[model samples]
Target chain A: MALSTHTTTTGFLLPSIHSAPPFFTQQPNPTTQSIASEQWIRLILSYARHRRLFTLRVEDAETAGNDWDEVLRNERINRRVLPSYLSAIIASMAAKNVAAYEPPKQNRSALLYWRLPEEWAEVLHEWAISTGQLNTILTFYDITDPPIESPLTNIPLPLLRKAITILAKTNRAQLIGVADGEGVRFFAGSK
Target chain B: MHRRGVGLAAFDRQEQSKRSFAELSSALSQSQVDHLHSQLSQFRTALAHFASTHRDSIKNDPSFRHAFQQMCSSIGVDPLAGPRKGGWWAEMLGLSDWQYELGVQVVDVCVSTRERNGGLIEMSELLRLVSRLRGVMGGVITEDDVIRSIKTLQPLGAGYQVVDIGGCTMIRSVVKELDEDQTVILAVAQLNGGRIVEDQLIQQKGWTRDRARAALENMLLRDGLCWLDDQDEEFGRSYWVPSAMQWDI
Candidate 1:
């Protein structure tokens, strides 16, 4: 396949190394591999943030399989990241606390943490106060998929819960658990 | 007649100063010879004191050591002759032997690794390899020290030079000089992870087909930048720059 440059749907330009064939393969040298893995992590995190994608499956993204993710596979270059290489990259990311394995033990899927839980809490708190949603109860779904325009809209529910937990720690927000679902109420001037 | 007389007097003065040491010694009285010996001993003591004080700086700082060598040369001293051959100056500053040893090792490393990197290795990578080769036996070699050693290698016409390619300081052997076109191609290849195709060069650099082909061919055949996939018709011809190639090990 012919190699071509890839850009995200939101127009985030991928680095030129993305089109290079060797980038998809695991570099043999430790120093070169370290640099390559760093670039890969930066690319993956930025692409995930741009698409607002929280979860990534290693099989779908890295290997040649039925459910192939375009971000990890370049058809024109005929280079798909080997599963072994992808695992190495993911292991490095986990070590650096940039990502956490979903289901903890399986290590099949990863939750990409482009922003730490503390930073996400600040984002949600800012949105709540600015949108006049303070002092009112918001379900996990409401904060993640708000009806009105807000920064928290479309945020994954599990990630939203982590953020809410941070706010509860500071007494800036209170979590209310009902039979059906969980909700959080934000307090004013939690800055 | 007056000008000729003055010229003759000036020539006589020049001859007096140029007299042989043996003739001057024969002409001097016993007391004068003793006074001259004391003065010469005093000068030697002062020079030895100066050299001993600045020994560390002379060993580490290149420019300071250069000026010190110049001063030594002006006084008819050979500071680099080693402790055995060179009398006091060599014993005062014992850096010449270390510099010579390091220079030889640098040449060895460059020649041995030339086949792999085509005599072009990044400064940091070269230092790492050289340090590993030395293995705690040799003293630490800094970038400035390496440059100084490479400077010493220049007189031999070995063509060892530190070149700046794509913002990286690379050591290139003078065995093969990369012309402007080959250098440009190498710079472009560096951006693409050491792999470059004829069409990419033409498109990115706005060069005609012939110009790109000629440069690539020169680099491949003459410069030893390996050509990849020459047999594969699908990928066309891609050139791999040995220095730019990120080796796994």
Candidate 2:
């Protein structure tokens, strides 16, 4: 059992199947590394979507006690997994319009929720209709910014921008800019 | 012997660990064994890399098979004849993988050292020759376009050798030549010893048997380069000898 342990966001511990040091490291063979990185990037995006998470803070993993953060940072795997390798995958995805980057500063982490804002906007529409909030005016920040009353609250600002644009296109919502308010507001279209 | 699946890692591992014959042979010098080992290592590495990198394509390519067979022969191992039983060295070299293998379909076309015009036939010359041949007549030709007509001639036991310089190349093949009953067949048989069949003249020319036969016989006789094999009922056959007629096919 050379297996390493990983903890999922839901707090379930599981053995890591892809725990080889090379799995974490960027491949010295550029071609293989690129392919592997693509696979990893896809997997990471899907995982984030499933967990409904955005904006992963690498440094806060110790405090948050999430297993993936710790597992990803393990010295054996991280030795080859350079920031550049991850960045390349992110950039490629962005160029294809498959995913966009929320560039990380010193303490900020990336927010990659594989589903784009347009998709989220659709989900929001369905949720609003089903939950009986259509044809209502709501603060934009109220929907996206969170007290976690709804699952959509956890979505990051980048995704919020996409969602707003999508809603505006269908004449489903109007974004009204207001001065001296805590956040923006939207008026839903049609019943 | 249990045969494990062969892969790059396994091949590399075996080559790295295997002991050379020089180690066991008391009479052989160490330096000789060391040199042989180095070459073997290089060959193994190249083979492993190629096989892994081009696994799918090689499986589909006939030329790749030919090249692999040639490589196996160069390694002093007949792919058909399995290694000697219970030999550690044989096992290390992956002899089992090739054991009980069917012989590779070998087709070679030998071209003469002279017929290639001192070895400088340009692509235009090859294209012109192919264009004259029946199937490719007026057909578009490209460097990558397959020489299909030549491949078909393999069953007739025709093959080709493409010379980069000015000499002729031989194509040894297993294809059947068009019989006299079907249509007229004309082959400019070279006078040299290797039975170099020059170019195939097919289609409308293929229908003109008597003319084709007469043309071949007259050309050979006039050039004094080759003697007709008048007995064989197939296409006009001849034995060409150099220094007599210059066969321009």
Candidate 3:
């Protein structure tokens, strides 16, 4: 087969010889798989951060099919192959501790913040400064709720919980349990 | 006498040894001794088995390698970086829980956003906001976000009436401000404009055809709103036109 070449804006040169058929396939050869998977991981993290995408509905994709061509071009997000191909990438990332998996629920979508733990920690710090809620109780939901940018909203719930747990350990935030007449909710606020 | 002394010494030594043996025997029952020995052996076997099994499973089972993939699929979540702790963690996330038992419901036509974008709030924001807050904070503009975006130009004058028809809530006003009557009639009139139909209005605002028509007629009498000439006694069969318009002020 005739070989081709492409260069990303980052100046990385990729040989396009084998990119014709297998590149589009969900399961590629080992080398191609690794490259594609890494690229996909990097792409999702960077793209999602740029958009600050916290929630994605299936219908949103349908709408975006016309509008957000750049995002829609990424084969990684094809919901048609979602439960299989896309899920595997998430699993791999979780296994490597490179990201978190927040299991999706109805009305709730998975958020993957490419921002690091330290970034999230810094955001929490800034939130403390702005809200003056130091040494106070805040719910897990409160941290992710608006009024400021939070990794919790942009990341999946499972990962967000992990981030909170990490913050608690670092003495960055305090998680308190308060009960009104109903049940208890976990409140995490900066210390 | 010397020979007898030697035999007695030997017997005394033998008795001492026998007492020591008896004490050891009494300390442990037969079953207990057996159980201890067996448990030690079992522990060794279990450790060996666990180590070898984990090693083998890692190599053999692709499912074990990609278990997190399955969890994400079942959970309807996009995956990210974190620890993979299998089924228990999955359950903790409530991935398989009833949060979605009713299934993912997409509002076919999002009304809340439309209300804000269409500037319908200038026409009706205050009245609705006040009515909602009636049981609470005295109709203050306490609602901060999108509700404010849809706020009406003026508060509904005190001369408004709230009517409940067949368990559906409708508001009526004479002096000014679009009340429940105008809103329902507007909804009915707007139905032909691809805004809403009878069932949708009924479902969304809890207005039956009877209630919607009464509200429509009241608006017509006031020369404020209009509806299609096609009339019906039943609320569902009739259509309406709401005169949500601007006057030459």
Candidate 4:
């Protein structure tokens, strides 16, 4: 009974049930399976958010090559989540708006939205105002992968775009299409 | 003639004495009846006072509570009856409605989850579920409370009974009675982590191959206590007990 939780490199504490063998297996009963799926959804979102992972591919998750993919399989217990069960869990997550299909039509992969675009927009605006980067043009890469310590560092481009779009809707920020990439110009006092 | 008159006087005297004796006996019996009535009332008052003072203990302690109910029944007092029904014992005990509400919730939890658990649930698991169902409004429901509620459910013949197997208390819905063979299989399965194989039973319990097979099949088909997996190449056919599978989650 040495069941224990694993902490991610980014300091996200995975729940103890993550390592349990049965957690990977699909429950045969509908009610219990639904609960298991809900738990799986919660775990995926939290893990993705903690490690700032924006996308989760079924292949990547099911494979043991990636360190972060340990959640999908418990090797010590020799239990690997079936692909069908994983797809069902992802489908349910998509239904709940917690995740979206990567290509919109294909269910092969999903972009986890632990924090919705609206929430990310608020976080971005707050960061800009506090850091005095308002009223200046910042490239998408600069905003997502800033050299200095910032919460928005390493944000996925698609999620970043969504967040910027939310700010654009509120007239707090404007998007600039450059020859190479896109840039966002935040307006001071336009909150 | 003088002798005849004397005899008549004596007969009259005897008749008068007999009448006086009858009156004396009646008066004596009436006083005894009054004394007995006073004693009964006094005893009832004392019992009521005792119940009120020890209400908490009686509610929390299983054995004590059982004894208290027995005592009440012996005196023709129903402690489980509604308080507003003017039963002195019920009012003093103040556990009737509480027990009744818990009983209703227990039945709900048990009935709703019966399909998954096959009408058999570990006592601790049942308590956890009942507590979750009741939420904040239900306060605390102890093991004793569950037992007491199950007791109240006995009259309904809902097949609610507590079974002790391998030192763990399991509540089995008597709707489907488990015969001796099924009971033995369940006990064996509990020891093997909610799973049992025909070979294990035959080897350990010294049962013949036919007897083990019959018992296992009966449990799977009739009692719904097991799930069969013909996919097990090693075991041939493996029976798994869902209730005994303790998922930490």
Error of 4 at A46 (Å): 2.0
Q: For residues A153-173, write the lDDT of model 1, one tens digit per residue.
A: 777777788888898888889
TM-score of chain A of 2: 0.69
Question: Candidate 4: where is the Cα deviation over 4 Å?
Answer: A1-16, A188-191, B1-91, B94-120, B124-145, B149-168, B172-188, B195-242, B246-249
For the second chain of model 1, what is the TM-score against the true structure's chain B?
0.58
Question: Which structure is stronger by TM-score: 2 or 3?
Answer: 2
Cand. 4 TM to true fold = 0.59
For residue B52, give model 4's deviation from the true position in Å: 8.5
Better model by TM-score: candidate 1 vs candidate 3: 1
By DockQ, highest first, what's the ranking? 4, 1, 3, 2
Choose the strongest candidate by lDDT: 4
Q: Find the candidate with the highest TM-score and give its number.
A: 4
| DockQ top scorer | 4
Instruction: For candidate 2, state the interface root-mean-square deviation in angstroms to 1 decimal.
Output: 32.3
Measured by TM-score, how close is model 3 to the native structure?
A: 0.31
Writing each residue's lDDT as its tens digit, candidate 4 over A1-191 gives: 33457765557777755654446656555555665677798898888766677887777655677645657765655556767778888889999999989878999788888998789899999999998999898898888778896888888788888898889887899999876789989976455
DockQ scores for all the models shown? 0.01, 0.00, 0.01, 0.02
Candidate 1 Cα misplacement greater than 4 A, ranges: A1-10, A62-68, B1-242, B245-249
For B142-182, candidate 3 gives per-residue lDDT tens digits of 22322322222113222333333233333333334666555
What value does DockQ give for candidate 2? 0.00
